[model samples]
Target: MKPIDPRLLRYARATRLFLTAVVALGAVGAGLLVAQAMLIAEVVVGAFQHSMAAAELRTPLLLLVAVACGRALVGWLTELAAH
Candidate 1:
């Protein structure tokens, strides 16, 4: 096996950080979805209301998309920085 370099280690750490952020954000987004669903269901059952309390799900989704885009950007940056 080849030996690992310190620079590569730093890059690896950066990649891991971004990946962790992605995972955390995904968890938050999923929680939001569940919470919203429950709230909407309760409202519908209790008050028979049919309106979105929060109509800005696009922001977090966009952030998710940005994080996905960051996957490539950070990976490329890490590779370039490592070398």
Candidate 2:
């Protein structure tokens, strides 16, 4: 195998770390997205199928909002890292 240059190694390592962070953040965002989707589905299904009251869904609705915000924040952080 060819020997790697010291400067090249530093740059490669930095790139790898940045990519790793971005991927981790992206995975977090994906998980948050899934949570948000599930929450929305539950709310919709509950309302339509079970005729659930808004008061009864307050917790899940709040959680849904929180997850949506979390997903947005993660997306913003990922964009910042990419730049």
**lDDT per residue, candidate 2, 5-75, as tens digits?**
89998888888977888999999998998899899999999888999999989988999989988988999
lDDT of 1 by residue, 21-81 (tens): 6666556556655655664455454443444343344444455456555555655554554
* 70 Cα displacement, candidate 2 (Å): 0.3
Give model 1 RMSD, 1 decimal. Answer: 9.3
**Model 2 bad stretches (over 4 Å):** 1-8
Worst 10 residues of 1 by lDDT: 46-55
Query: Which structure among the candidates has the greatest lDDT?
Result: 2
